[model samples]
Each structure stands twice: as structure tokens, then as C-alpha cells.
Target: MSKRLLARVAALTTGAALAAGAVVAVASPALAAPLGTVNLSQTSGLVTDSPMFASAVTSAPCPTGFGEESALRIGPAETGPFTNLTPSLGGGGYDKAPVTANPNRSFQLALGSAPANGRWWVVVECFSLLEGRHPDRFVTEIVVAGNQWRVPVVEATTTSLAVSPASPVEAGTPVTLTATVAPSGAAGTVEFLRGTNSLGTAAVSGGTATLTTSTIPAGSWSLTARFTPADPGSFGASTSAAASLVVNGPAGGVSKVETITADVDPGAFTLDVAQPPAVELLGGQVGGTATGALKQATITDLRGTNAGWDVTGQLTDFTGAGNIPAGNLTWTPSAAKASGSGAVSAGTPANLGDTRTLCSSAAGSSAGTFTCDAGLSLSIPDSVPPGAYTATLTLTLV
Candidate 1:
């Protein structure tokens, strides 16, 4: 997350790389190179009157926003008597026009009324909404002998890689490498490499693959990503151009006089509970209750662990001249200080006769200081003999 400009550069570079590996940057001036040859999808000889199928390959997509339509037609001569294969023949047209989008387009036609012993041309015509009709382009030739044959061609693919932290980084710094494959949806795995050695292979997802590593030594590295397609007949293999990285050695060029002399303790989960001020019944009553503010209690977690803790409190029977039951004390706990605004929480109200949680934190959440306080209530049964009773409230953290 350095400069936004650098992120954009990486993205744009990836797009250009996948268009033609690294060659796209300096390739032919023709920004639009959509015309490619037409061929059958199979090597088997075309059957007479039966459906004959083929796919045309295009080097690039159609001119943008033109609604350009590509029609596949067949004929005996390259010049005349061609029929568009639109249900009038064997009834088929491109799956997705190789001319309009990708290289995996198909068309079918029948040789029902023609003499079976001659050559036929599988032609592609490009007609746009406003641009009208373009020229016919063909690559592979076909022959016939009671069965017409068309050549089958596979689509070619390109791969591009991007690396980050574009600037020189310290040795052992984690670096991210991403590979983008074009025509957008080629299925394969990308192998990330440094020089000739591979760092690892990552499965392509959404036409892109990624790998992260932090084990590089100090030096300059030429990194690349090689794309190995799952179906070679449908798409071809490709490798991205090498991107460069420079890693500096460990910190140096400074002298140390001497090491300091201080012993360091790992850490501790320390808890401090303050004694509460005296609680007094404002008026004499039978089976009555008194409420007071509980003192603040602090808990700090420095153990560097993924554990949680709870602080509970219980009370001893009140005793002065006479005794009162500890069960008469109840508290509503609150966190005066929440370490992460979430890690620690106040506990529910409970009488102190039995230990009850006052404050607590979940595992992996107890990493900072937290302070807790509560409202205290003292309820005495009418039968209890009381005279200035006192009790101890024990708080424990674990």
C-alpha cells in the first residue's frame, strides 16, 4: 500500500502482459488484429449431407462498441457461390464469434446439394453496425473426396506477471507475485519462478494466479509465471515476461559500542483488585438491602498468548458483633476500561455467596489492560441477627 500510482502501474502492466506476454508492448502497430483462419473442430473427414463443424481463430477481439458480427460461410470457390450457414445448410453459427470475442467459435453447414469431390472454403466475414462488411480471411485449406474436410485450430493464450513492493526491499521481506492469463478464462496452474528455479505453483482462479514468499536471499531476481493449460487442444501454453526485484542485505554500515545490560521478562497477566469502601445501611429495617459502588479492579494481559480469562468474586459471612449472610451481597459488573472495546466484558449480577464472574475476556482477546467495577448490594434476611456486620469480598483472576 505505498503509492496508488504504483498499484495502477502493476494492474496495467498485467493487462498488457496477458495480451501478448511481453511482446504486446512492442508488437505490430495494428491495435486491432481480429482476423484469423477458419478450420473444422475435428480431424475426421466431413460426412456428406451430415453436419460439418469448425471453429475460427481470431488474434484479438472485435473493434469495441461496434456490435460487429462475424458470419461463417462455405463455398466451392473462394470468390463466389458461398452460402451462409444459417439453418439453410446444416444449421449452425459461431458459439461466440472468434472475431467478436474469443478463438473458440463454431459454425456448421451441409453439403446436401453439392458435388462431394471438390474443395470448399470456410470463410469469415466481419460486418459492424456502422462499419459495414470487411474482407474474408482464411488460413488452413480443405479438400474433398465424397467427404469434405476442414482443418482444426486451437486458440493461443498469453500470461503476464506482476510483483510488488516495486522498490528495493530488505532481504526476507514477503513479496507478492500475481499472474494474469488472457482471453480471460483459461483453466490452468501458474508456476512462479526466480531465475530458473520455481518458487511454487498456484492454481489459476478467475484467470489469475498468485503466490507469496519471504525466503529470498539478498540479490536481484528475475521472476516469471508459466501457464500450463488443462486443455491444450482448446488453449495453448504461455509464459509471462520476467519482472525484476532487488533485495538488500541485512542492516549494516554501523558500529555498536557494546550491548546493554538489562534482563527482560517475558510478560505477565497481572490483576489488582482494590478494597471497597465501607457499606452502611442508611436506615434500620428488617430483611432490608443496601447498595454501594464497588472499587475499580484492573487486569493486564502481557503473556502474549491466545488465552482468555475471567475474574470472579465471592464473599465470606459478615461478622462484627453479630454475623450476616454473604449471600446478601450482589453486584452488577461493568468494564471501566475495555482493552479493545470488545475483548473484555462485564459479568452478570450474582450474590457473592458463590463465586460469580465479575469481568472476563475471550481467548485471543485478552492482550491489554482492562479495568472493571460493579454496583454492590447487601440484602439481609429478616431473621439474620446483624450489628455493624462486615465481610471480605475475594476476587480471583484466571
Candidate 2:
């Protein structure tokens, strides 16, 4: 072979060798660029009761022509092979599903079980294309809870309750009760309780609940307001300080007088006459024929009056044919009886066309109530026509 031809062959071999070396260098794995700056939803004040969130934004895309996987792990500060709290991302692996050219990524880590009560850290690992079975990237570590993350020890919130018409309300009067909850942004309802009995439940608006009722008994009452949080894990239940309410009994006074009038029914009466052989006749007696009930009056004078009060009644004679004398009918009033207060006296008897005092109560006496029970008696004379007789009776109070 010629010497020039041999030199040309050697040059071609060197060129081929250099090209193979370049290809090998391109395929080999190298340290990956940073995924980006990781930002936690909450860094220092995280608690085990709520979910954790994280996000990362990259200005530059993932290494071209290579797939990347993102993952999040939480464990004790000095532990290796930390627990994969978000295994659902990568099918039970600490790595998330692979993606190409991810510029921005976010993760929501809801730990299936609460971690041990201690300090913990969150590690975000972004892996480049795998070489065989191993990731070719480093992890970014963040101290989420230096010492603050643990099972939450919730503290109760203060509450205040108030009642309208504060106290000493007259019986049968309606009252309004209101409760104000602290952390006014809390969302839920409030239940009002009287002693141990539940009055009702009211939805909270602007952190306040109110109830109005008129059925509360006349006595001292203890009222309380209980708050039920919509999310118990986020906030604790709270109860208001006990409130006092007093209701008073009704006032004392005289009631309006009521009047009742009744008619009389007189049956046949036997008559007796003095004559030869002393004849005894049927339906001939002058009197013992008329029957009647008294006109009634009821008065309630609960206020012990300094001066006495009197009840009087007046009667008018009948005006039918063969007029019977006004004096023939007599009216008698029975003793008045009082309930709960004051005494009463019997009334005087009077003929028709005259007024008679029915009852009287003395000063400072326990006789505040009065009722009338007047009776009437009729007298018929011989030779009187057989007819019905009626009279009007009027009762007055002073």
C-alpha cells in the first residue's frame, strides 16, 4: 500500500473514535439542575390536624428530552428513608409520575395517619430521567416545624351572652336572648339553654344568635349559649358564661265587675179562707207562690282598701192589672263570701220600690271580693186576679 493512503486511513479511524466518544458523553447522566424554589403553604406553624400544601415554580423547563418526577416526603429531622406521606402520587413510591417539560408544579399532601408528636421536616425531591432504576437528582429539605407541629392542643374560646329586658320583667312578657361568639369569623350555629333544658338552636349571623320567647315561668333562670363549630378540627367548641334572669309575678288590683240577672218562676199555691165550716180551698193562698234568684255582682278588690266598700240593690213593683202593692214583695240579700282577700257582710231586707245595702267590708279587712245572692218573697191577697207579676231589680257598687 502507498504511505499517503495509510495516513488517510488512520485519520478516518481517529475521526470515528472521536465521534463515538462524543455520543457516549451525551448519553451519560449528570447532576440535574434545581427544580425551583419551593414555597410551603405554611412553614413554621404547621399542625398535624390539617393538610399541608407546597408549590414550586421553575423559570427554565425540565432538561430537554428527559422526563422528570416530583415527590414530597416527611419524617423526623435525623431519619433516613423518610416516610412517604403522599405515596398515591407515584403508586406507592416516594416519586411522583413522570412528566416532560414541567415548568410549574404543586402538591397537596394529606397524611393518611398522623405522625408521632415531634419536630418534623418536609423534603421535596425532583428526579430527572432515571439511570437504570436510580434518580439522578438531589432533594430540597425544609424545616416545616422546628418544634411547633404536633397534635393540636386546642383552647376554648370565650363567649358572652345577654338578655333583653335584662331582669325583673313582668310575667307573661316576652324577652330576647342573644349570644356573641369570639373570633367573629367562626361559622356555625348556637344553641340556647335554660338551665339544662334546650330552648332552641339558631343559626349564627355575624357571629351572633338570638331567641325570643314569652313562655318562661316567673322565677329566676340560668341561661347559657353553646357554639357548635362547622369544622371541629379547625376550631374548638365554646360555651358562654351563665346569665341570670328574673321574672316577677303579676300585679294586684280590682277586676272589672260582672253582673248577672235571673227571672223568677212562681208555681200554683193553695189558698185558705175563714168562713162557715172553715172551708179549705186549693190554689187560693195569698202568698208562697213566687220563686226567684238574686241578681249577682262580683268584684275583685285585692288592694286592701283603707276605707270600706258597700254593695246595694233596689227593687221595683209589678205593673200588671189589679196592681199588687210594692210592699208585698220583699228582697233579702245573703252574706257575701270573699275568695283570697277581704270579708263581706249580709245585706238588709227591703220591700219593692226601696233600696237595700247588700254587703259591706271594713277598712284593713281581708274582704276584697263581694257577690250578691238576693232572694224575693211575694204576698197575694184574696180576690186577686190570677195573673203573672214581675219586678226589676238593680244592683250598684260604690
* Candidate 2 displacement at residue 182 in angstroms: 0.8
Clash numbers, per candidate: 0, 10
- Each model's RMSD to truth, in Å? 30.1, 49.4
Whole-model Cα lDDT per candidate?
0.59, 0.49
User: TM-score per candidate, in order?
Assistant: 0.35, 0.30
Q: Which regions in candidate 2 have their CA more than 4 angstroms from the true location? A: 1-156, 252-398
> What is the alpha-carbon RMSD of candidate 1 to the true structure?
30.1
Error of 1 at 338 (Å): 5.4
Candidate 1 structure lDDT: 0.59
Q: For candidate 1, what is the total of clashing residue pairs?
A: 0
